[model samples]
Target: MILVTLLSFFISLSYETIIFCSFSITITIFSLSFISKYPSTYLVDYTCCKPPNTLRSPSHSFLKHSRLNLSSNLESVDFQMKVLARSGLGEETYLPPAICELPPTPSYEASRKEAELVIFSSLDSLFNKTGLNPLDVDILVVNCSVFSPAPSLTSMILRKYNMRENVKSFNLSGMGCSAGLISVNLAHDLLKTHANSNAIIVTTEIITLFYYTGKDRSMLLPNCLFRMGGASVFLSNKKSFRKQSKYLLLHVVRTHIGSCDEAYNCIHEREDSEGKIGISLSKKLTSIAGQALTANIHAFALQILPTTELLFFLKTLIVKKVFKQKNTKPYIPDFKRAFEHFCLHAGGRGVINEMQKELGLSWEDMEPSRMTLHRFGNTSSSSLWYELSYLEAKGRMKKGDRVWQIALGSGFKCNSAVWKCNMDIKTSSDGPWFDCIDRYPIHVS
Candidate 1:
């Protein structure tokens, strides 16, 4: 009887143990399934506006109609012409029709037309490529540094396309060139909360209102650099769009030092002595931009750098802190190891030159930015996309390649976006650079 009872008890305990183990696995799998469903942002496709050749103005013609031409100050005209020549801008860069014409007609209507022309062309191209319905966009973000009309850029887009009533929209102004990545970051955050969704970010600068007629040499600098261009990008979190997407967004880092009085005032848009409104860039801008870029990239490096690179950086930090090696500079990890391509914002020739020197980038690494600046001039927030498109047009983008886009803007901000190519992207004669890409990598003397 004792043997029988003991055997029965042992059998019952064995059954219970099996049941508990099975239940544990069931609960764990359910938790894993929930976690696995979380969404990720993808760059579906994008298109950039190439203003018609009719708008393209050669350097000499532009100088003739230049506001500085009105000054009749031979020295001032000479100064602008010299700056334009060395500006890394080719003769083919475009200007708004209004600005290209004599006695420039910069009114609300003209500005609206320019916006419509740029935004519509880009959106139409993106829609054609992706076949994405306008109403299907869950969120819309438009960043134009100097232009935000009463209806708002987002509102204007909605009116034109007749999007859904519940679509989330954001219009960003005064955010400067870095605003493109700011838009990307915002869309990424909203995508996290909204579950599966589609987003469109349009980056552009309107020159009509920003055209400085003032004679401040600092103000006239913009006239010699900025041109007419824009880009529209599509982002999605839905699983269905993954197959067609171009890149998977890995990270976005932004560094804003606007709190410093000098940084804040470095690029101020105010009235000149004659009360002509324009943005005056401080001579201190280069150093400030350098500081912001260092802060931005340092943060991003921690996330993207290889384990070995991180260990080396950490070792340097320890040496500096524990051994008091005040003379030893911390390691600047090789960014080339972290990314296959770098799209430094075509902010300016000087900015690119400084980056090439500081980061130790080769001419080829700096080519996209230099070529974009030469072909498109500075398109404000949209310049990074043009550089990226330049790479795509050059047939340089390939499957699994990593890309870095770094931009600096008026807020005294530096922002970086990292992406991994999703699939084997076939090289094609498509995008803004298709017709002119072969002519690029030109000697920018």
Candidate 2:
């Protein structure tokens, strides 16, 4: 009798173990399914435990019944959609040797001359490529961060292009990389309000004018940092022009930091002992950028899909915990999920590395960005657009493809713009910079 009882006890224990394993497997499968569906449905939070007060009702059918009740309460609504178009207004020339290698160790006079020529040559090249009538422009937005022309860059563009009298114009000063997208956002608003209006946005920074005059090691940084860049983006509300435009304005997110005097120290324009004006960039710029990204992305993700959040979480955990490297930062979202192409800001080698680390992206992922930096240096606000053009030049974009363009500028702000590809991307013959698409994955020295 005792032997029989022991045998039965062992049999029961084995059965219980099987049941436990099956239950665990079922839960695992459920979790995977939940994650997969979370992207499409807003019902993600259900897979996890309910918060403090929401779990009071313990019926097995409570979750399903709640979903049924919510669905039943839906109301129908109709809304009209508005769209804006921004066209790549041809390519422009960049006189790198002239700006970076001026004579006399780069005194003020040489700097001034380089600045003037940069503006002149860049505008002329852009107009020629765009085949746009200069006098037809209705609004002008010109941003020359460090070197605002004496009569203003806006006036210069108008005079050279022979723009009409009553042409509305605004010159943005000292608003770094964020300025370009800000200009785009402004144009979107203006075009939406007015009918048959064309808004021209010109982004360029004549770094030659702001080139360091002193031998101060701190001042010497800009000499190595700033690069020649200028671009013209034409925006309009006309639906007919939308089909050929490279990117439709999906959404723009902007986050401003360092608003107060102390916080303003995050980024500032200051002078050296020689009274020469120089933009003092701080090492803290990266930390500020990370913070801004968190805020901007948080707001964006709420409006976007939960898949974005999950991807962000996975990338973050893998990079922060599994990698166990101090230099390694949390992963930025796999932009590939939301965008077919990426135009990350090519601020510097270090900046590029940080972005790559955070995103868990390979060097190939940053090819456009790295190439932009190598070829044009930091073109300020226009760098992201240049990267986009690089991808287009390579024939990488296909219809319905999406792009994520990110920019970091003064005020320690990080701004992002999403674009969708509508048509075949063809290489332009008039571009100031050519894409060595065949020789990409280049050795990054």
Candidate 3:
């Protein structure tokens, strides 16, 4: 009787073990299936503007014109010109003819003309390269920080391309330079809801209308840094395009510190004591940007960093927080291990230098950004794309490589976008950097 009872107990244990194994297998299959069906977005192609010949104005010429046009004191004009010379922007950077003329007053008509030229040229080239009709685009996103007309930039694109009547359109204004990636994040969310959709994002800033001609030294910074540029990017979630796409959208992380008064006012548009309206970049902008970037990178690393990196970061956090180790510096993750290419925003030379030091990036990692700034100046939201194009031009981009694009904007916003290369990209003739790429990776100081 004892032997029979022991045998029955062993059989019951064997039956329970088989059931647990079957359940585990079922869950594993379901998880795999869910991952396989997860939605993905692709960047099929992109184009950055090579500003028209009529718009090109060398730095010395621009400074001389500004000195003559502004009624400010001679000392102020000379100081501003000196700032421009040391701003690390090369002579090739283009500006709208209206701004280069340094009109006593900003011209709305000239600003509109600049927009039409930049937007039309960029969109035309993008459509021609993608071979995808504009009408086929289901969503349109246009971002211009300082320029938002009554008809809206998105509406202008619609009319120019004669897109579908039911197409969804969005215009992001006053979001500052980081709005480009903001638009991309918005499009990614929209694509998830609507399958088999195509979205085009146009990023540009109109420096002509926003040109500050006043004597305010802070206001004059934009004049020195901004130049004519625009970029058009095509994104699609259609599985069919995956094979031909250039990059796969991996993640977009954004952090805005506008709630802090100092941050909100770090870069602001206001009328000065003379009632001259202009964007005033605060003296504390670099510090505010660094803080914003710290917050953004911390949040972003949580999502994409490797397990070992995260573990080390957590250990450091524990030592600082739990052990009350006040002297410990926060661990900076080695982003180089994760990203093969870096597109730090070409906001200015100072901005790039601060970022390089903070992130511990080598000069080679910053080459595209420095070159883009030297070649194109600060193109606002479009600068990131120009940097990416530089990497493609040099044949540095390869399949499976990961690219990181980071931008800081006036809202005291820091934003990051990560992309995995989908295929080997060849330098295309339509790219803004294609012709002069061989000359780039040049010394810029």
lDDT score, candidate 1: 0.85
- Candidate 3: where is the Cα deviation over 4 Å? 1-38, 102-105
Q: In model 3, how many backbone clashes occur?
A: 0
Candidate 3's error at 36, in angstroms?
A: 6.1
Between the candidate structures 1 and 2, which one is better when assessed by lDDT? 1
Model 3 lDDT tens row, 176-263: 9898999999999999899899999999998887887678889988888988999999999998998999999988999999999999
Q: Candidate 2: deviation at residue 335, Å?
A: 3.2
TM-score of each: 0.89, 0.69, 0.91
Across 122-173, the per-residue lDDT of candidate 1 in tens digits comes to 9999999889999899999999988889999899999999999999999999
Native-to-model Cα distance after best TM-score fit, residue 224 in candidate 3, in Å: 0.4
Per-residue lDDT over 224-330 for candidate 2, one digit per residue giving the tens place of the 0 to 100 score:
44555666676666665566555566667877765644335755678878787767767666666666666666566533323434444444544455446557655
Cα lDDT, all candidates:
0.85, 0.59, 0.85
lDDT accuracy of residue 409 in candidate 1: 85
- Which window of ten consecutive residues has the lowest lDDT sum in model 3? 6-15
Candidate 2: 10-residue stretch with minimal lDDT: 76-85
Clashing pairs in 3: none
Residue pair clashes in candidate 1: none
